[model samples]
Target: MLSQPPVWFILIAFIAALGPLVFFHELGHYVVARVFGVGAESFSIGFGREVAGWTDKRGTRWKVGWLPLGGYVKFVGDLNPVSMPGEEKEDLSVEQRRRAFHCRPVWQRFLIVLAGPAANFLLAILIFATFYVAYGRPETPAVIGPVIANSAADHAGLKAGDRIISINGSATRYFQDIQAVTSLRPNYSVDLVYERGSQLRRVPVRLGSEQRLDEFGQKYVVGLLGVRPPQLVYKRLSVFEAVPAACGATANVTKMMVEIIGQIVTGERSPKELGGPLRMAQVAGQRASLGWSDFVYLIALFSINLGFINLLPVPMLDGGHLALYTVEAVQRRPVSLRAQEWAFRSGLAFLLALLIFTTLNDLGSFGLWESVGRLIG
Candidate 1:
């Protein structure tokens, strides 16, 4: 049985994790718009009716909303909070026209839209760099340790002290890289290149897998090669050196996310693994209990996820807006209002369905259905 955190703790942790990310994301757009001389009417931390607000010196209303899951910026000359151009914009005075988002150059509008996701990626890099500078990098060689009897690694003629040089032609710099590559493709065959002394060999290995239960009673099926990594050696890096390493780490994470999404789309992985607010809250609380460093890492991870999600070319999202801008740039005209409306409607429907499904997954992960069944019996 898994011990669950108190509901209050989950709520607090979730808020602490999400609030800053949301603020920074929206702030990115707001700042860039200001740079282009576009005025914002309102800047909100969350959606829905405002809970509390005050007008800034620049006349933008800054507010906290009832819903904390997401946020937005309402630019001047926008019909509503979605940043759709107002029909009345054409009738605006010269000063109002100058400050209207839609009236800005297409390049400026594109940059403003792009800034939000860019900020999120930047945030993750900063967090990772800070951690690397503080604790030094864990350098673990990709050498095979003791092999489990009858395991895939043992049957494949892998020996102790053999160094994994690459997987399917991609170089493996660390033991972690080997684990990452193998863990995603259970029951699949991969070409493994390893070095024994001065001799290099390539062998095809069918990965093995085992079902494991976590503390929350959720099951995961991960590929197993039955080889362990040697003890980690810490290498301290200068701040300058850590910056590029941090950027590489962030890029790798983004790449892995793209690959996982592709797998899910192609039916190679289960969509049920998708999580929603409940799972996030649970994980946030658990990480917070571990330590501040753990919690900070969680925040960075979520920030990346949020940024990537927004970059999907779906209407009503930043990517969708970018798509529209691209079309506008090519055609030298904005997309028709009717087309924009339909696209936004479709996007809204898709997002809503995704939210509902992921929420259900969260409930299933928490064993809520099982608990209900037991009570009924």
Candidate 2:
């Protein structure tokens, strides 16, 4: 088992990993707004009081804020960094109106808001592609190395050296595919086909259910086949080949994330398993200790996650901005300012509640509450 790092290491790793992501995400919004002729008032790398800043030729203040957790861009004529439209937009001169985000066409505003998440996704793809081109891809064939005793695989007569061909009629090209298929079907019997020394065999295996707990003590019921794979094989690809492969990998991650979210929504999974910054910090620290490659991989995963999260249609997110633009397009008018204010307030509340819940989950994982209980006792 990997040993946990000290608190300082975790904090440093978390900030190092997250800071670049926040910068690029906000950069996307800033660039697009600039392209659309909208002037930005400020480009901040973090929140709270500004620590250092410089004004650009365009009069945009580029600043680093005290808080390094998140960042934002404030466009000209916006009331705040969240891009709430200013009431003074109507009274601005022609030149000022041209530079104002709210005064821009709905489509342009939509694109500007959409750019932030889009940038994060693009960044993930680029990073994955670069890694693939440099290091080649790991191809783990669906060949069984060993079958655990008393496992579903053992009960179903699966043997060492068997190569899995398909699960539940879906052809599996890699060992991960088998995991992907079985994980979603806990306690269900599935038809598994494999090849053993030129002979093909089909077996009905009832996947065993295992209750696993995370570092946070959150429980999960996952299907287990109890088989291990042989050593991984690396396949070198040309730069051109790696791009599409990287895109496919990103898409697969996105699909899996969506499925997990859906499972949580349907009560198939518990929301207690949700993690916050502290959990991320722990994972980041562990990956950093492993090596640079592992750390970069973690960054890529988090980047994709950040993009997907921002695309959710909850108000105050990038997706919510796009959603409002869609409504404006359909209704041939912008949503009322009062309605927008209420919606934003509600979104902020929802986000705060979620943050608090996840933070508590993190603290519990660190045994903070247990320590407190011991002290009280």
Best by lDDT: 1
Query: CA lDDT, every prediction?
Result: 0.90, 0.88
Give the alpha carbon lDDT tens digit for every residue of 78-138 in model 2.
8888899885666888888989999989999999999999888888888888888898877
Candidate 1, residue 101: Cα displacement in angstroms equals 0.9
Instruction: Return the TM-score for candidate 1, rounded to 2 decimals.
Output: 0.95
**How do the predictions measure up, each by TM-score?**
0.95, 0.89
Candidate 1 clash pair list: none
* Minimal lDDT window, size 10, model 1: 81-90
**Model 2 per-residue lDDT at 286:** 80
Q: After superposition, how far is residue 338 of candidate 1 from its true place, in Å?
A: 0.9
